[model samples]
Target chain A: MANSVTAAKATRGINKTIIYIVCIGLAVLSILPFWIMFVNATRSTAEIQSGLSLLPSTHLKTNWDVLTSKSFDPLKGFLNSFIISASSTALSVYFSALTAYGLVVYNWKWRQAFFTFILCVMLIPTQASAIGFYKFMYQLHLNNSFLPLILPAIAAPAMVFFMRQYLLSTLSLEIVEASRIDGSGEFATFNRIILPLMTPALATQAIFAFVASWNNLFMPLILLTDKSKYTLPIMVSLLRGDIYKTEFGSIYMGLALTALPLFVIYFLLSRYIIAGVALGGVKE
Target chain B: MRRKGTINYAKYGYIFSIPFVLVFLVFALYPTLYTAFIGFTDMKGVIPKPVHILDNPFQNFKELIFDNASFRQSLSNTFILWITNFIPQIALALLLTAWFTNQRLNIKGQGMFKVLLYMPNIITASTIAVLFSTLFAFPMGPVNSLFDALGWSDAPIQFLQQKNTARGIVSFIQFWMWYGNTMIILIAGVMGINPALFEAAAIDGASGFQTFFRVTLPSLRTIMLFTLITSMVGGLQMFDIPQLFITPAGGPDNATLTTSVFIYGQAFKGAYMYNKAAAASMIMFVIAAALAALMFYLMRDRSEGQLRKKLRAQKKAAKAAARGM
Candidate 1:
């Protein structure tokens, strides 16, 4: 019996060691490209061309100079992306939560139908609507404006679905009942009372919506015409285009700068993000 | 059971959902319907022009699917990239899921590894594309230099300039970016499985691999289906990485051009044919819908099987009763 127990323990040790090695190896592979990107951002064009390394260099300022001197305009791109994504996220999160709450709390006639409609809409790929959307925006004289980027957030079916799932799991109608008893307006109850209760869900959706909108390339690429109005992704694409010389150091700097904000945001709210994914997976 | 002074809450539902309803009408539904209509018409440029329903309503589709080699190439490239990435991606995700959820393993730093792994997914595709293009840049790039130093080749190869290499790199990047997300979802799936089942498997003297195949995978069927369908849909719409990696024309002889990129080019690029783009978009929609339906059918619950068996038994009993009568 003792020998059998010892063998079991030996197998456990082997399994644990194997798991550790795999986990650590994958973690390294995951972060290697980001490390290379940051490292290359500090090197000169020639140095970057020379070879790859695990060390940093002293030419970050030179890269910054080259990046700013080029027509890429990283600062403007950052500002444009920030404005578009922030407004879009705010619109999507608040409105989606409201919609989810509305569907959950009220015993309206069309509630189930509306929910099913949103689910069906979720299945229709947005790429199918690109042609008419482009033409419609042009006719509306909204081309080159941020309205096209910001306004569509109101119809984010995925966020609506997720928020609805979150609400169904966590929210209690008794609070809405109590708030109504206190003579509070419906919108006021939603804004003042229910919104505070939904902080975790809202934050999760906010991060996701922000990242999605910030990384959006297709819509903005078609809508915006002015270089001054370009988002970070659009500008980065242009930099990588073959029309320009697009210096290696400058491109890396542009990429690093663009990704840094995402990394910071992700690291800050990673727990919520991870939990959100779990929530989504389990509910689905 | 009527309350004393509760106000009617049903009205507020309409009020709260007004923004969403309006947005959907103006943006989502209308555009889709309009695109379908425009697919049948020959409208070019940005303006509203006269579109006659000429002899061939299906002309745009026929020209696109049959005559347009670029469209066909894009379709094939998309499938090739998605399948290549998906095979290894699902494998790695399954391995990671199995390892992370193994109770006996008791792996350390699982949270840190998860955070690091999922980091690539959160970064913008454009940024990743730019970073990778530089890494694979001609002659002077790090990959080529490393290959030369390792004596794999004396001369530096322009990785992006070769068709097969470009497609392979793009596929690899897609795999690298998505495998983490897939692993997390699978871990959630494994976690959802009953602990009693694992204990039962252990008591039966089943090995880890045996337990995984016999118990874990069967329980995870629904979640696996969910992941597969989602990944398939996302893969079909892949645009940003391929768009930025290759030139607008899907360069190296249009090897990396996805359908979405092709549609974008047709709509917005030099010639600007909105009609053709709409037709292509409609084709993509059909393909995506058909694929999703097939996956759903394939992964449907076995209640149908039970229903069929029940019906067969009922029919046999009825026949036996008739014969006895």
Candidate 2:
């Protein structure tokens, strides 16, 4: 019996070592590109052209100077991206949660129909409506403006779907009943009582919405024509495109700059992101 | 339990729903309807002409379907890239899911591994495209340098210049970016499965592989279907990586040009053919919708399947009785 137990332990030890080796090796592969990007950001164009390295070089300041010399307005790009992503995320999460709240709390006549409608819209990919959407924005004279980019978040069908699933799992109608009994107004109950309760869900969706909006290239590429209104991706694309003689170092710096905040956000809120993925799967 | 003056808040539902409803009507429904309407017209200018049904009804589609080599090429390219990326992505995801969720293994720092894997997804696709291009550029690229060190090639491969190589790199990058997300979703599906079923299988002396195939895979059908459909939709509209990879014209001979890129090219680039873009967008929508419907048909529930069987039996029985057989 003791021999068998020892043999079992030995097998488990081997299994554990194998798992660790695979996991760490894969993790290295995952982060290697980003690591190269950061290292290249600190290197000169000549050094980068020579080959890739894991080492940081002494030309970081020079790279920044090159970026500025080339008239790459990273500060403005950052601000524009921040404004668009923040407002869009806030609008998407709040309105989606509100819509989900409405559907859950009320036994209204058209509630089921409205929910089904939202689900149907969820299946219609945004690409399907791009042509008319562009034309519609043109008609409204909203091109080159942030309104078309930001305001459309109010009707994010996927966010609404996610929020609805979250609300179903966490929200209790009795709380609404209790709050109403205590003379809290409907909006007051939602604002004061419910929003706090939905913090975890809100945080997950907010991060997702923020990331999506920040990384979005398609709509902004189509809409914004003014150089000053360009978001980070647009700026990155313009810089990366050998529109002029390519400055490889400067381009890498720009990419590293764009990704830095996202990296920080991910490290801080990764748990919520993992939870959010589970929530996404709950739909099925 | 109905009480008077205790707050009839049902009316506030309308108030809450109004914002979403307005945005949907103006942005979502209107644009889709307009796209459908514009597909049948010859509105080719920056400002749309009043679309009349009788005015060159099939002109845009004729151009998109038959006359345009680039559009046809892009259609095939989108499928090729999606399938190439997705096959490896789903396979890797399944492997990771199986390992990560193995109850016996009890993998340490599972969350850290997941975050690291999913890191590529959060980065801007444009940045990634640029980064990869630079990393794998001809002659002096890191990949080529490594190949030389290993004596693997006579010369550096022009990764983004050649058609097949460009497509391959695009597919690899796409697979690298998305497999993490797919793994997370699949892990969730695995976790949602009843532990008791796994326990029962173990009690019956079934091996891990046997339990996975018999208990886990079948149970994950719905989740797999959901992932497949969403991936198909996203894959069909793939634009950013391919468009940003080299140029908006798509890499060398338009090998990496996705359908959405084609639509963007038509709408925004040289001559700005809005009518042709509308038609292409509509065609893409049909393909996406049909794929979704096919998934739904194939993945219907067993309970629903049984219900249909019973209904068919009852119908046949009723027909036989009516015929006095």
Using lDDT, give the best candidate's number.
Answer: 1
Tens-digit per-residue lDDT, B1-325, candidate 1: 3457556778988888999999989988788888888888888865567877647999999999899999999999999999999999989999988888877766778898889888899999989987888788787887887797788988888888889999999999999999988888889889888899999999999988999999999998888888787788888899999989876548789999999999999998877888899999999889888867766576655854685588579769978987787
Error of 1 at A95 (Å): 0.7
For the predicted complex of model 2, DockQ is 0.62
Candidate 1 TM-score versus the reference: 0.92
- Of all native A–B interface contacts, model 1 reproduces a fraction of 0.73
Model 1 whole-model lDDT (C-alpha atoms): 0.86
lDDT tens digits by residue: candidate 1, A1-284: 99999999998888787777877888898888889889888988888877878799999998888888767788899999999999999999999999998888886878878986786567667798988898889889998999988998998888888888888778888897788778888899999998999998899889889999999999999999988999999988877765445478777888899999999999998888887777676654
lDDT (0-100) at residue B96 of candidate 1? Answer: 87
Q: lDDT per residue, candidate 2, B1-325, as tens digits?
A: 3367455667887889999999999988899899887788767766557756635688788877998999999999999999999999999898888888877878889989999988788888888887787778677766887787788988887877889999998999999999989999899899889899999999999876788789988988889888888899999989888887876458788999999889998889887877788899999989888987776677655864685598579768978987774
Question: Highest TM-score: which candidate?
Answer: 1
How large is the i-RMS for each model, in angstroms?
1.3, 1.5
